[model samples]
Target chain A: MSIARFSPFELLLLKSRSQVDTATLLLLAWVLVHRQHVSEGQRRRRLAQVTAQFRHGHELGPIMSIAHSQDLQAIQLAAEVVRKECSNERSLSALYQAITLATDDGDLSLANHYILRFLADLLNIAPSTLSTLFQELTGKPLCPPEDPSRDAYWQQHDPEYHARQAQEAQAAEQQAKEAHARAEQRQRAQTEKQQKKQQKQQQEQQRQQEATRNAKARAQREQAQREHDQHEQARRTRWQQEQARQEEARRRQQHQRSSSPPPADRTTRALAVLGLAPGASRTDVRQAYRRMAQLHHPDRFYSESDHLVALASARFQRIKNAYDYLMQTY
Target chain B: MRDLYQRLALSPSANSHQISSAVTHCANSALRQDAETVLGVAEHRDAYNKLHKTVSDIGQLRARLGLTHGAHWQGDVANDFSLPPDNAISRHDELVDRVSYAVSLYNHWRRFKGPLLLVALFTAGAGIGLAFGFTLGLGLGTR
Candidate 1:
């Protein structure tokens, strides 16, 4: 309860926030701050007074003109002049005409300018302020609101009111032109990117062609070397076979003369014939097999796993079976 | 003829504003009258007064015509001096065709400025008495 706690905005927004818990507090706050100085009823009455004054033509004077010199003799005549000039409908029309002429022509009587500017400014400020505040608070329009004006019809209907609108329109057109230019730039950039993509593809094709040409040269060189190596190896095997036949003949002749085998071979033959190292543990066999398999693992040949697996299994199984037979027999 | 018809057809109600308005208008209209409009408008005391005694001479000439009448019909006679309606000018009608025009006589009388209203009254007596005496031819005066 106490209303002195809520802020001014909170107080003013009470109409929209009535269902909220703080509404009572806000309303009381509003009354506490403004009610003492100006009550709601008093505000309405004052507004009515203002309207009444408006009807009575109690507006500020914009200009003064001297007319009917002999008739207008009073010393305090200026005060009554404006009201009297605007008394009836015809005079009121004349008064408005004078004001319009003054405004259009400018350099009008000082009085006329002041009065018109004042009325226009006041009316403009009041309604616009109220509208902005209400709109901000209510989140909806305050339609059919009071205008209390005579020129609203002109303002609303005259779409092409010959004010300074043309200047703004020209500026807006220029802005549109700039925006269009930016769009064109974006389009140009997109086109450039597409052109660059085509260029990059052409370059990649050129690099691939270069790589193919280099690969063809490397394959030709490698093929020549491989053929040369095969020829050398065949020559060596032929030489060895020839040497073996010669040596066999010479050894037969020597054996007939000496009847003894070559020492190196006899030694190896004796060892193999005796077969002294027959027993071996699984660890020893595995160690010996690992050493041999390491030299022939699939990584050494960079071969496929399927081919490596087949070759490794066949070789290891034969070795294991021979080793196992030797161990069982001995 | 059109003007005459207009005047004849006009009712008094066709006029304007107030009776005083009509009176004021009529007076002001006579005051502003020129020689052109003077030919047809009413003859009043001011018109005669404005003539500067041209009427007295017309009256003296009319005094020779001795046709008199009994009572005053025109207006009050000034100093009881005026002329009768008949004169030597009327006797000329003896050798010519005679035509008595009342409106013409009234116009002539109005044109005279010197006591025209009074003279018209006095002339009626003179014209009637003279006519009776001329009828008797030797009639004596009755006391």
Candidate 2:
């Protein structure tokens, strides 16, 4: 970068006589476009110097043809050839410096901007890297070489065109990230909802099963109670009927005993005194007593002789004695 | 010793009707105060029987003598004992009717014995069957 130590122009003069390759031709064009002279005499002196250098090497015709060409074809062709020869970082840096100086202007031309982009493409340098190189060479901001909204040729020729293509690329990347995040959130929420629904269904099923089991148990208990009550009722009824039968039998036995006759014995002898049979019943004995007492009662013989009443009373007394003995003994 | 006729307040030569009437009168006098007493009535009845037997013996001797004197006995033989009163006979008939009613009731019981036994058996069987059925139903229901 120091003019006193090493100059691009002097370097070109040294390589001029050795070969007239595309690198040597590009160096010459770079010097013609970027170099400044204090006076016309200075410009004339440099031109003479370059011409003499090519004439001494007997390559003046080709060099002069390139210098006098009114198009950027030679510059484009030179850039292609230099791209092959200069692949190292130092050579790329030197080429970047030369392009920067050639394109530098208070107001840049469309032809110069096109030639710069064409050279950078051949050299496989990114447009952004070229901007960084431009800043390094001129200590100023780099102008991007794209603008689709304008006329394609006009944007290339426009000055003060330093816009960023990086913002658009970053925005596309951020949008993709946001879309992916939203999709993941929706998937997670759906999975949680499905799990909750399944859990609720399982709980409902369990409750139903429990309720059914309880109902079955209750029904069973109620049925058992009813049956037990029925069985108890039957048992009570049977017991009551049996009791009634026993009472009936006892009543009949009592009636028979009271009505039946007494056995023949000392009581039977007494019964005979009342004109009853030997094996007479207790009822017969009472009947006999009533009969004899009525017949031989003293009142019956009151009107008759004393002897007759005495006889009736004696007989009645005998009957009464027998009746008493029979009743007491039996 | 006092004679049997004297005990009955009769003369030794009295006829059978006169002797029987006189004996009844004497016995009635002795039994009238305590006729309801068993011991008194028994004692009176025993005395009357003994007197009657002795009087009959005396009468038989007298009858033999009378027969030698050409006297015939003309009294009915049934006149010696008295018949029971009509009310006594009616009481006896009433007793017979009661006994007959009791007999009829017993006969009715005998005639219906088979059906009554069958009813009792059916009741018992039905009770047992109902108990068993209820027990089985309860067991199954509980299970």
Candidate 3:
């Protein structure tokens, strides 16, 4: 793949064996390519670009200082090391990265082109390949027309440049404020959603509790109804039993009354046996009993046959029984 | 007339003197003793005569009421005047019958209560278990 997709520091680190050597080489190449005198603003801008590409921001300061010193021996050493460490493809990729960095300002100086050619020669790349790679990256010939109008060095000293810088800074501050407001709004929306969820859960719990209470109350009422029905059944049974008992007692009393004879019947029969009327006096009952007794007495029939005497004895016994009954009843 | 008077073949108006002579001349000693017991005491004779009189009066009443045959009387004064088989129950006997009825009812309840209670408890437990299982199933299904 072409190293055009990779940043300058990333390509340098990938091709170099040591991280410190790669950083030094990358910075040294950048400084050498921008060797012409430039404004401090341009220098700081270039340093900012390098620092942004470098993964380790804290270490870039010392590497940038060393590269800015323009020490020829350190430059030569970094170049030699890069040349020895890189293969042909990696050497081409490293050179391509450097070309990309140089064109970031929209232009390359003649001196920067010379330095690139020197780096290509040191890495053993053919001059034709360097021209082709540079053309491919920048869409221009290796040697191009000098255009001072494209150079920003004079504009950096202009009053309008300072005003544009102030405007850009103000716009950046306004964007930061808007971003903070959006984040606060998102946080508020999230908190409100959480509170709504909590309220829904509480309402569901209350509904479940009400259902449970209703079920419990229904069970209690059903139990009470069952108990009441049982009590009613018992009461009905007792009432039925009491009614049966009263019926039996009434039947028994009726039976007794029906079976026993009346007292008046006995008095009339006793008077009849004495040969007296129903309303006869006690004296008349006695006189009739005595008269019947004398006539039917067994002693008066003693001279008769055994049969006759037996007959007389039975007759006399009846008359005697009737008299005794009459005397006591009267 | 009473059986005692019938046994001696005597009239209903026979006196105490004639009753004694009849008893003395009776053929059977047992018959003589019975006749003596019934006729010798005025109170016993009265009770005997009254019993026969009650039977006779009942017969007369039946005739007056135009009830033919006199099925319950039949001139057997001893049987007729005897109490009507004493069918009325005593208090103790009735109490015993009532207690037995109560005991039988209790036994019937006892016979049913154990299985009924077990069925009730089992039904309640099964319902509770089913409800609990259904609730747990719903909860798990929701999850």
Candidate 4:
């Protein structure tokens, strides 16, 4: 694996192409450098990291196909196209992204070196420039040490390396602790937020229940009041009806009493018809009748006009009827 | 009959000569006839006097009882003694009653017309929909 450093101009040149072309070129360069040296999983992870870092708007499917391809000619052609189309600065930036993908697992193998060297050569970059860029990105010489006992030489002469390692180990431990503490804090905040939300929901439910209960009670009270009013109105109506009925009865009784005349006996009427007092004798009745009959006799008025004769006849008949009644009673 | 004497302008104790003179002078033929029937005989005169006295007593009693008019009584006495009775129902009253009844009927129809129209429209629409659906279904089935 190797790391490559990019200049600002080289980064800008790399991004200047259409996003799909840049992404395809980047993926092709990555496949060329990492296919031989890295495992498939490591290559995929590094490809993801490089793509994310570049923020390229490319789908993963076509890029994954490029990474899986074993066609060396296609890879070489893609490299040549990138070299011809882009400036040397853009080509270097694309090569640096490929180197970043290869070196993200933290080591530069001989296979990664050969493929990257091949890509640099195809891009028309000099070996020295490649070595210099690799050195700048990884902080090491591009080639391995010549001594076969490389570890022994570093262990004997570079004590600071071991110190730096220990310092890095300590720094990693501190970062892990901080990350754990942050995780616990996030969890605690989340739990508190959930509890507050639950409490709010419970309060809302209680308020809704209270509102429902109040509505129900109010409805019931209103119903009761309405019923009471109806009953009161009904009672009042009945009372008014009763009062009116009694008044009608009293009025009817008064009308009956005032309208009906008192009874009169027929006997008094008959005695009056005979022109006799209540205590008058049969002789008095007869005398009154004879006096009336003689004055009104039809034969005596026969010589007068016919109207006078008719009037005398009716008068004479009444006198005779009264005399007969008096004679029978006496 | 009780007023026969008053009709002839005669006293109860008048002799036949005075009664005949009054009857001959009476202007109304009906009055003359009533006078002749009531006053020509002693018994008839007595009967008229008795009936008159009874009616006068009743009228006095009603006045004491605070009945302002004899018309309040459901009796022939009111008809016989008071002014002519007025007709209870008039053509105008009958027309008013008929118009009011018709107006009430119109109001009832107005009150119910909207709901009735809605119901009729709903029924008609449902019927049309059902017929259309049935015909379409039959055609589809035959096909």
Candidate 5:
């Protein structure tokens, strides 16, 4: 390679100690030089030139030693120059074609990925975009297949995690159902207690209302009874007053009849009924009438014989009349 | 016997003007010195009241005798009723004199008013400083 062209690739391989073989070097050089052109004649001429320059075994040792001697700053400067030169699609297409040719069995190996990653970084291509390009060019997966050592770890733990999660979900479901049942029971008990309390309060109010009504009825009955007793007493009093008036009238009539002494022809009969003399004053007639009443009153005939009672009644009548007549004459 | 005129610091034959002026001067001096509280000690107020009653009595007696000036006099009453002797009158007079003396001394010392104010300010500042230092010490000790 020319000093100007070799400097950048030297920078890209600065940290790589594994030496590139003659075939890979020639192939990489041919892809870089020939695929940049479109004509078949120009591609053949460039491929011959790259093969003739680095075909010898002795040339690779010097080239690799010189690449190793370049410092990080020099490498970076050379990479910048190369990135400006090879930023187009043409150079990237050439790199993909070269990587495809370098891979054995049409599938990328670890060493192939390392080389592709290194070149893609220098070329300002994203790692993921480069991986896709590598797969497209090589007709294989960008990453290597997982070894059984790594796969065995996941295979051992995946079912355990799934089973644990299923168990946890079942427990949670059971717990939720139990909690719901308990809450329902508690709610039912609370409702029942509230209903009982309400019923008790209603009964208490009913009892109070009944008692109030009973008290009112009793009061009314007592008032009616009191008024009835008062009326009865008044009726009795009126009856007694009427009876007393009747008795007084009867006594006055008897007195009037006794006072006149049956029109006596002489004053002697009248005086005898009165038990007074013919010349008696009004005082003697009154005294004799009072004495006759005391001895032969109707009130004193309770234990007497029937004939004696009649006799005393007639005598009293006569004595009363005679006394009244004497009082008038005097 | 010391009479009412002696208690009022006037002659017995002095006119009303002399008696009023003496009373006014004594009362003004006592009030300025705040002597009412001093007189209120133990029996001092009682003594002063007694002196005041005696002066009032004598003044009334003189006025009544004067009102009957042109009228026919009843009898000779001058030598019959003499004023009673009283130690309270003298004691009250002495107390009033001492109060006046003390008031005069207080007014004289009032000339150093500015220095007294400075001394008061300094005392207040020192008290504040002492309190601040004590608080600072307590805070440091707790820490």
Candidate 6:
């Protein structure tokens, strides 16, 4: 960067020629544009020198403008070349500007048989989306130079356009909030109504059940009262029949006793059959009966018929009942 | 370390049901690990002891053959992989370092016995010399 030790060739290139030719400038531009090995700082410094003519706008104006012009043929050529060959962001931007300027010249039609010119119109889309479309069409990214919305463009359109967008966004947010609140309130109201309706239905069902229960209890009580009345009536008839039967049985017994004569032998000698002497002690009579019962007990013979067994068992029961009754009466 | 926890069916939660489910998931994942790769870790651990015992038996059988310390007595028979405190990778490095250092020391001892033989000879010579001097002094003093 110091001037004292400058190379002779640099001094010659800077001062020897009053003006540089286009071919040399083009060569310099080629090297600066296609530089790969140079460091980034050196590259920028070199490219700045190479493009100084375009910035300063001194000479080579006619050829440079012609090479990138607003003429119909020139713009079409630039567009074609850009789609095919322009790789850098700056060249693409230049081509796009050229196409827009040509359209402004009014040679291209609105829907016509000529070149396409919606270069400025494409700005309506998002830059990223535009870049993607360009890549899809061209097979490579066509990055615009320095994000075309620089201070010059943004200063003109930022306030009113962005303000309108912000307003629309705020309105949409408010609308969504109101819609959500309304939906929640509607849901809560519907839930409360359903709950109240369920409560009323349950209360009605409970009341109906209680009434049915009470009616059933009353019916049961009446049925039980009818059953008790019928039982009492039957009991009275049974008691009356028993009283008549008892009186008839007693009269029959009295008639038999009065009509029958006394035994001629006048003896209580049934026990004498079992070897009991006259005036025997009760123990002696009981011993004789036991001996006789043992000899005649149906259980002693497996071959005994059920009728014989029954007769023996009945005789035994009669003797027992007579003994028990006599003992109590005595 | 992660695989170890997953293998052990250990989970990370306070709720018993969720923890149990997570533990099941961990065990299932461990069971499904590419057995060709990870299954050998267990086999290798088991075979390590087998190799140690075999090498020791073989070396003892062939004590003359130069495989003296083929099986080392000092070794970690078990290793539990877990997240290390302070440094995780350092533990692995430390284990490897210990094994390497032990192996080197065993190799050196097995190969070299020069200084040891020399020390033994020197001590034996000194003992003999002391015994001879004491006997000579006793004989001369008595005479």
Query: Which one is best on lDDT?
Result: 3
Question: What C-alpha RMSD separates each model from the true structure?
Answer: 57.5, 83.3, 70.3, 65.1, 61.9, 45.1
Better of 1 and 5 by lDDT: 5
The docking quality of candidate 3, as DockQ, is 0.01
Of candidate 2 chain A, the 10-residue stretch with the lowest lDDT total is A1-10
Task: Report the lDDT tens digits of candidate 5 across residue range A1-330.
Answer: 111233433333333332232323433543232122235444444444434533233344433333234233232333333444454574475456556544534544322333344455445566567667767766766663221112232234345544665699899999999999999999999999999999999999999977876778787878877999999999999999999999999999999998856555556778877777677777777888899888878668634333345566777888778777777765
Q: Between prediction 3 and prediction 6, which has the larger lDDT?
A: 3
Off by over 4 Å in 3: A1-58, A144-330, B1-143
| Cα lDDT tens digits for candidate 1, A1-330 | 122332222222222322221222221121122222344454344333322323222211110111112111110122122222333443333333323333222233222222222222222224354335334444544343111111232234333432445568788999999999999999999999999999999999999977876777777868877998999999999999999999999989987866543344433332232232334444555565456556544456332223344455565555555445434432
Each prediction's TM-score against the native?
0.15, 0.22, 0.25, 0.25, 0.22, 0.19
> Candidate 1, after superposition: displacement of residue A17 in Å?
66
TM-score of chain A of each: 0.19, 0.30, 0.34, 0.34, 0.28, 0.24
i-RMSD values for every candidate model: 51.8, 92.4, 79.6, 73.0, 68.2, 41.7
Q: Which model scores highest in DockQ?
A: 2
Model 4, A179-258: lDDT tens digits are 99999999999999999999999999999977876778787877877999999999999999999999999999999987
Clashing pairs in 6: none
How much lDDT does each candidate structure score? 0.37, 0.52, 0.60, 0.58, 0.50, 0.42
What's the C-alpha lDDT at position A321 in model 6?
A: 53
Position A247, candidate 4: lDDT: 100
Candidate 4 chain A lowest-lDDT run of ten? A145-154
What level of docking quality does candidate 2 show?
incorrect
> Candidate 4 clash total?
2
Off by over 4 Å in 1: A1-159, A162-175, A182-194, A197-210, A213-330, B1-143
How should the candidates be ordered by lDDT, best one leading? 3, 4, 2, 5, 6, 1
lDDT of 6 by residue, A82-184 (tens): 2333334644453343333223222322111011112212112334544454544445554322211122222243455446656998999999999999999
Positional deviation of A63 in candidate 6, in angstroms?
Answer: 4.4
